[model samples]
Target: MTAHVVQRSTAETTLMRQFETEKLSSSPRRADAFGRFIAGGLPTRRVESWHYTDLRAAMRDAAPLAPAPDSGAIEDARAILTDRKRMAAWRIVLVDGRLVAELCDQFPPAVSFSREEPSPVDVDDPMVALNEAMSVEAYVLKVADGARVEGLIEITHISTAKDARSVYSRVAILLGIGASASLIESYLGAGPGVQRNSLAILTLAEGARAKHVVLVEDDAELHIESRLGQLAAGAELNDFVLISGGALTRRQLFHKLIGPEAKITLGGLTLLDGKRRSDTTLQVVHAAEAGTSREYYRAIVDDEAVGTFQGKVIVENAAQKTDGAMKSQAVLLSPRAQMNAKPELEILADDVVCGHGATVGSLDPEQLFYMMTRSLDRDEAESMLLEAFGEEAIRRIEDDVLAEALRRPFWAWLARERVARVGGEGEIHWVESAS
Candidate 1:
């Protein structure tokens, strides 16, 4: 009998070799993370957690890690700094996963920033493990107790490498008790055929309040983001993710309510076209008493696009009086477009209230006809309905400025449906007929 060998894929082989040479491979934490990654290789369709989108198949080739962005790339990124007044919030620029201090703006006095990486937190997610093992740069932002950050903090991640590359980045934000702040993460891709792994860990002290937004600028080959957070007593967290780019994207969030009376509200909006595939997965746990969480997502899939939303909420036995709701809605604009929504709730508490639901459909023909009766073009009518459908999630943003800034990307995507790019964020094809 001949000995049998299990052949690994090129991507897996490349990452395996890279793990052996990882800069932090000597560290026990990174070594463990790499061990976890190697044990699984990559998440495949067989993995229950990654059933909708098989990351292993999507990443067939392992692109070398991107280098620190060059000066020209940094300069080009700076040129994209527009509406200084609108996005005026402070800035932290990360060019190709490495921070460029000169490109960043001044942070609030109550805020302290450092490039030092925190001790890695153990996580089970494959994406988080990959980030821990391969990331080249990491930072931590601290907000002092009783302080209110005057300006929103914007962390800009720019991928300027024009070749096939992989960029790993990580960031952590810790808000002290009674501290309040708004933060934005802008993910900008400079070119095509790049794989990016990004991770963010947020911690909310007792009585702290935070609003965060993750905005993906444009299309990328593969973009995987994992966000983990914990909330203390009386803490509040409101988060939103806009997935308008990436040919294949998977965003996962895992949060736990460890303190009593905590609240978490999150909304996600995904706009996909062509052959794009985007998956948003969330898992929230209520471990204490009187916790409340609401999660809603809306996806607009066009052409041959595929969109998925997988959300689950769990209430522990100690979490009496817990309240949670999760709903996902999707509108498919093409017959070939596909959507998968799985909303789940696992409750161990008798007195807790939790429910989950999902809905999928195309635009209402009657509504479209009504708009057309009012002299609206068919395509324009369809676009109007799509915008209206997505606004439910956008309106959840309490800050108008932040909401407007977030809206621009959607309008730009709409314009792409019928016209070429103009100049400004507000310069959508208002007068142009989508037809």
Candidate 2:
């Protein structure tokens, strides 16, 4: 097999040129966004936060921008949102960067909505700039203060491109004080060469409660980058993400505890095989006193797949009594498989407890053998052991249905493992849990 290059390509210059050609009918904010994109270019491994996953080299060969499909089969892909119980809650749907009004439900009557134009962030982020410059539609959702939506709200992003395509999609959510709801977002696709840039900004008012879940399962060849921001005071935010498909994917999440006594919990699961790659990077800020945060991530890597996790927690001087902890574990299924994890904590406040842990290893053969000796076959024993390993972190999922659905891809991957010949397999069978 040819080795995958980890070097930057000429696309940085090419992407800059392509952005210049488009007569950007952008506002000052949008123009600033474009400027930031050009300034930051693409994130590289050299950047401390992006040291594990290098987009400079991974996306260097990406094709030029393409238009969204005029019309193609989009119904089948809609299965990601078919649950009516969940469908009755969301107020927005963006299909390949464009709004799909027909499939979107209604928002609470007390809430107001608008998508006038794209706003610029102060940071010089190339990906953010690209998304702001190229995106055509924006979905904005707001929940009325003191209101409660008992059902789950789902935001489905479907890639309907037939061939090579590029899309920029954006969404903004705001929850009023004392309001409570569950939000679900999914990235689904059915094409060969499609790349997507997506962003979501979420705000929680004082004393509000919100649970957010993201599921990314698109074409194995699709490239995806998503940015999510959360702000709350005395509010609570719980985020859970499950990533199973994508040629290359990264989800960057930022959480700001702006109000005293606010709490946040972040949890996720990643299952990859073959040469697939997924990165879940996060940054949490304890900007207020008595704020607390916890994060845990588990990854199952097989084949020659690569997994990266970069987590950072910043505690401000005024943020006393802050408690933060992050832990990550990866089970490699192949000798060629790779996993990199970095957990960082920066504190200026005394009187706080903060710690992080990271571990990388393969399944223990002794345990496997012991299980098999109990009358179970190799396949059954391996599957059972693997499930037990993942369940440790998966049990944290608040929703049982979501947890079961997250296990489907893993079981399927295990079922496809070559059981006839054990010696023929490499240290980590790309098909088992490692590549």
Predicted model with the maximum TM-score: 1
Against the true structure, what is each candidate's TM-score?
0.94, 0.87
Report how far residue 233 has shifted in candidate 1, in Å: 0.7
* lDDT per residue (tens digit) for residues 66-114 in model 1: 8777788888777766533348468888887888988887776899878
Cα deviation at 199, candidate 1, in Å, is 0.3
For each candidate, the alpha-carbon lDDT, in order, equals 0.85, 0.72
Off by over 4 Å in 1: 1-6, 82-86, 420-435
253: Cα error in model 1, Å: 0.5
**Could you tell me how far off, in angstroms, the CA of residue 346 lies in candidate 1 after the best superposition?**
0.6
Give candidate 1's root-mean-square deviation (CA, Å). 3.8
Candidate 2: C-alpha RMSD to true structure equals 6.2
**Most accurate candidate by lDDT:** 1
